[model samples]
Target: MKRFLTLLIAVVIALSAMSTFAENAKTLKIGTDAEPIGFDPHTTPAHASIRIMHQMYETLVELDDDLNVIPELAVSWEQPDDLTYIFKLREGVKFHSGRELKAADVKYSFERILNPDLGALGSTPSYAGNIDKVEVIDDYTVKITLSKITAPFLASMSSIYCSIVDSEAVEANGDLLRADGGTGPYTLGEWVPDNRVTVNRFEDYWLDGYNFENIEFYVISDSSARMSALRTGEVDIIIGDSAMLSIAEAAPNVDVHKIRTRDYITICLNLNMPEFSDVRVRQAISLALDRQEIIDLACDGQAEVSGFAPASMGHWAVDVNEHPLYKQDIEKAKELMKEAGFENGFSVTCTVGLNDHIRNSGTVIQQQLAQIGIDVTVQNKENAQYVDDWKNHDFEMMICQNGAGSDPNRAVAFFFGTGANANIAEYSNARVDELCELGAGTTDVDKRREYYTEAINIILDECPNVTFASPYNYYYASSSLEGYSPTLNRPLDVRNVTKE
Candidate 1:
């Protein structure tokens, strides 16, 4: 009887200790501008969803904090020839769905993204569209062959677009947009649209150092409200702008961090629209708007007046502002408008995202373009509707940020490379396509620069889109949060982060 009583007491004490440990596990809450667009990395375009998906998915290769390619699922890879690469996976990596990750799953993921008829309409497909074949050599080995020799092939795999998923899970469910099939550190827990998204840590995650039990992204659209939440300790961090950086600087307990990014605030013109079809008409619109003034008024003077690529691209970046097309020329714009058969500028709607920067820029652009007799009506739709409209190419002109990277192909090719996956404008130019291909096929920096320069010059004259200001990815976090660092691409890496 005494032995039984002692055993019961011992079990009770162990249970109490376990309960306390579980309660002590960290839960990170972040205040974001918006909720995820969807959970699927291959089908996610906007920043809101990409950030969440990175936490929920794992690519074979991933970008480190320095934007360099580092092995994730793939321990190592070798290129036997210019066109073929063999990847070796680590042991015992498991997906959030069910079973362990295998080479077949990687093959399946590549095939799924490269499938033309799959009708997956996201921008991610382009990163893998060059893949000609994916063959599973064994349970832990896979070989991939590109259609052609490419300079950035290895770095391309580092993109979130190359995330690997469970083949069986995807086969059972057409897509994993709302399902869990990733082998990342975290898996989707619950999501309430336009409200909050919670992702719990994966117990079977192959890598170590993810100490947080779960991470929560609370959607707080209003910048001021997000600041308030940060102040009240409702959120550990917030995606903020230069304005919020000032606020964080003022508060003693808040920490301000900024990543010099290659992102650009641009106006996308749909070519299908008759008004924007004529190159002269597009050029006129581009010439009429003042990018510097827009940057000052809308971006709080926190952005750089740049070309298609941000200045951070260094030698590869184009300074379109140095050319006449980007200079504000009202008379030339009016003359071009008359030549395009619109003597009195036509009316068009400029769709803006649900952010103060975009809204202010759109409004300022509306006033700027009016100088050339163009009638601009600015419109702001709800989050879902706006993303839907942008995806469907339903807008005449949309004001948004163009996500660029350090790669030469990223700035000129991602959207403008003719038949590109993310070419929302449906624009095609044979010369530009040829130049982009030439740029990607070589490792010679000088040769690549010449090719990209020609392409950007043509794009500027053709005016498929107008680049205005280059903005930085600014973050505000509490002092208690440690090990959290943001990359230039704005993908969140919380695996090493801890909350005090």
Candidate 2:
């Protein structure tokens, strides 16, 4: 009888061990607002898809906690001159399909960006403005040569546009779709376009192992729906505006994270038009509104009043007071409008995206501008249509919001340069362009700052954009999750995240 009892105890212990192991092997379910239109790192660089792809693809460089570029695929790099950079790729890294990553692949990936047939797939001119050539030095080394001295070279590499790709996979797939061909910690398992995407951890990943076994992304675009999903445990996390913070704070088993982002929402004025060419008119529009009131009503006080773009994340933020563009004065605004012959007010169409936060803010601005005698007709369109219209410069004014590039130079260049993607304002000042060019070509920090400061003054004086507020990156995570680190400007990196 004693022998029989010992055998029974052993069986019980074995079952308990198996149960523990099963509990530990939990899969995390993450939901986001729509998979980006394309999965190609070059095509849909800024879309949510790249964030998901980052798990499946490794970049040559990755940003650290302080927002500085650090080596990821490239073990080390050196600048032979002001315009040339040589990177030594890390050896032994393999793609998800068991092929080795090579320097030739890096060259191919970059060259793909410059292809004219790819449309906007080309390198973001704002960030890659100075890059002239990419030369493969050897099997594991490549040299990046710029046309001019670029201070933000490392920071520019941190962009999704520069993320490394597997050449074999690109050749096979023809375009970046939902597939397993990257060198990241996760591998694409399934993707349902516009609805959901799923990634499973790559067992043969070259870097540290991912915490979660699988990540499932569900696109929940509606703010209310996203909040409901988070509260009901249908999803593990939801990223949205400050308006969702109240609901998030009250929800059980939910944690709300608010990080200051480099994103800013402003009014993009068409400077190419004669009416908006007057700087006083631009300044008047800026000063006429009560920005703080708008922040409270529209964003629930979850935004910071912006001046000349937001500061870089973490320790690199320049002193806010040192920048003059952030100053607010209503009387001065009215005076400038009168000086520009718009004291009697004029009818203008303000185009806005239907994104909840943007639409809500546009509504608030419509009321505020009305108080100043500006007859603003608000036009709300779907996000895609709004982007297309804005890109083509087809609107008189637009409710524009953009996340700044990793570097200040890149950020300023995109918005203020002569013909940049976000330069919807169409306002051109020779001085501003010169400053941007100078800043882009200078490697010295102080010299770059001088150029940036001069450019900021020009933008403020010109009033291309009626600067409003810089919103926080707000998201809710399940209480059971751990090790999720959020960056200010970039999308959430889920490879290191794990559930408790």
Candidate 3:
């Protein structure tokens, strides 16, 4: 009896120890869709790159769940004039390198990115392209002047591309990546190329909510692989699609999360191409596509068919059914094609990235355009090559996704503005350019939206591109994980996450 009693006590102690160990686990693992190109905040327009950089760096401002402008690094901001804006930094905030964040640092960061030599991606018309200069007023005060008054300037400040860097560290390492040059909740840790990047909690982080000791973002290119990782307990969370959602819903150990995103998909036509140069041809292609069917076939009915902007943007978005340009008419498309001197058909290649949904959309586009007497061959490329081709304007037709913004200026200005870097279609319109300028130069929300509205209608008429579907992003996590609230801007912030 004594031996049996001792054995029972030992078993209880072992169980308790195991339970404590499980509760104390502080590492949060995520399986992401793509590997980040680099940790340099200013270099890439890829969301994957920004998503990982967000863990270690922060912007001056951020949008809240309601898409309201809120302060992040800056305590507050004021616009003294139409072109000049001033910000007051948060006192006591320290960079991961142990130096206090100051106005000088902000000035240096902005100047470095703005330098044409640096070739920062955000230097293009879509992002910080409006900024004229940065001035350091004092240790805590910074002033920024814009060449022109623009609404996107405010939204641009919230982008990760404009993250303030530790000038001292950059001087030491020559770049921000692998240098721990930020004031955010985490510090850059190990980065194994094509595998994973780890961010450790900055012990001196200024905020209170971040609790995870380490957050690891593992790149699993294949969706099925990511789903398998989440299911088998290799990864705690995963960014997934409808197929993953269906599988995860049935998995007892997984918890599914749905984020209403402003991410919209578009099929861009190279206006430089001879066949796609005609407005009638472009408009016909737009009419040929059935946005609803694309959403259903590609997204598994987890998206809204839209025009230019997604329905998630509230009043800023145009309804597909109501918009004449978005209305599907196979007969109209054929007639337009005939009028454009392509009576029988034309063959064009549609390029796609590595993402499954995007690839599926390319395939669906190929099938839909066949009705309009157009033959499309879908070509898939590795993510890196795809980004390269996209940036160089190398494809005839490409299916891509863009992050949606609350402000109409950001939603349209970056992609539709003539000479804008994000304008993959190389679409040019004098009236649209004028509307973008008028919209951006104004502070009034309603008036700015009216400008965008007019510009959008003109863009539709011209048919430079087709903004089709806004799909809901689905993520799945381990049921035991807690405090994993994420937004469209920072989808994978696990700072407050804890193993329950």
Candidate 4:
């Protein structure tokens, strides 16, 4: 009897310990569609990678819920002149590696990003492309000198790609993604390729209210798989489009949130390619596309047909109705094709990413163009390969998404400006380039609008790329998850999030 009692006591103690662990160690599991390429904020440009950077690193500034610029590592900033800006850093902030945050760290981080030998992939339109030099004013302040007056510099500082890293950590760990050490809310704990990433909450995080002990980012590329994970209680949150949101809403104890974004889908035409060299051919292709039909079929009416630029770009985007090319006129398309010496239309391959909406848009475009006697052969590839092919200019045409920028200058520069790495279409117009420079250099809203409008009009007239639609993003969270508000730009900020 004594032996049995002792054994029972041991079992009870173990059970109690397990319960305590369960209560103390809360984890929020999220089903992400794709895995990020790396954790390096300076180089990784893709959306998945940017989301990870937001958690693992801290930027000099951040955006509030309204997309307004707010303080993060830097308490405040002031423009000393058109070409120079100064930042006052926050003191007592601790990096994950235990080094105190200082102005020199900021200077080194910016310098590393701007280094040509470093070859940062995502810095062109924002950080390295705009800023010329960084000067440490003191232990608590830094001054940035720009080659020219960049109007979007403040907002760009809030971008995830501009997140600051510890110089000591980077030197010790080498320039590797997984070697992340920053003054952020979390640290990468585990990464299983094509499976999941686990992050542990930093005990010394500067920001408060990050109550969850762990966050698990599970890879579920398939839409159904992601929803299934959420339904089966394997994941507490999943981000999807409108169709997936409908299914998630029907599930028990799930809440759906809508995010407005400037992200747009475009059929990027290779202007240097044989069939697309003629401007009439490109215009015909745009007229042949029924943007509304594509949006309705592919996005289930969850998207709006945008003009050549995203409507979310506020004053910069020309109204869709103002552009005659946006209207699908099959007869006019045929006339233009005939004028361009291809009345019967020519077959072209359109490469697309593995995402459902992109592939579906390609299919819809294929069917719609067939009505105008154009044969569009759809070619689908994985996301990474597609991005590489795009950068290499290896396709006749391609369907892809363009990320939103802090200003019209960024959006215009990304797709149409010369020397922009994101200009996959190989499009360049001297006038458009001049306007982009003008827009970037000016702080006057009216003057900037004029420059952007002219550039947008020129691109639309030239038909370098067909901007079809902007799809609304949807995210589903378990009812117990709180403080998760969707935004136009930042999607993965879970700092203040708590799972009840």
TM-score of each: 0.92, 0.86, 0.93, 0.92
What alpha-carbon RMSD in Å does predicted model 1 have with respect to the real structure?
A: 4.8
Q: What number of backbone clashes does candidate 3 have, counting pairs of residues 3 or more apart or in separate chains?
A: 0
lDDT per residue for candidate 2 within 1-500, as digits (tens), equals 99999999999999999887565545666667544555666655334666687777767787875766899889999987888889999999888888888898888877776665664433545655466888888989999888777777677776666767787787888877654557887788887866888788787777674777787878787878888887787777787778787777887788988887777778888876666788777767776667777788888898877754575433223444434444556667667778878787788888987355577788888887775567888998755567568757899878876766556666677777776656778767788888877887776778877887778766766678877777777878888777776666445676567766
Q: What's the distance in Å from true for residue 251, model 2?
A: 3.5
Which candidate would rank higher by lDDT, 2 or 3?
3
Error of 4 at 34 (Å): 1.5
For candidate 1, the 10 contiguous residues with the lowest summed lDDT are: 118-127
Where is model 4 poorest over a 10-residue stretch in terms of lDDT? 119-128
lDDT of 4: 0.81
Tell me how far the alpha carbon of residue 31 in candidate 2 is from the true structure, in angstroms, after superposition. Answer: 3.0
**Candidate 2, which segments miss by more than 4 Å at Cα?**
1-25, 45-47, 116-126, 171-174, 177-181, 312-335, 489-491
The Cα local distance difference test for each model comes to: 0.81, 0.73, 0.83, 0.81
Superposed model 4: Cα runs more than 4 Å off: 1-25, 172-174
Give me the runs in candidate 3 sitting further than 4 Å from their true place. Answer: 1-24, 124-126, 169-180
- Clashing residue pairs in candidate 4, if any? none
lDDT of 1 by residue, 439-467 (tens): 88887889989998898888878889987
| Model 1, position 384: C-alpha lDDT score | 71
**On residues 284-310, what C-alpha lDDT tens digit does candidate 4 reach at each position?**
988888888899999888988886467
lDDT of 4 at 437: 88
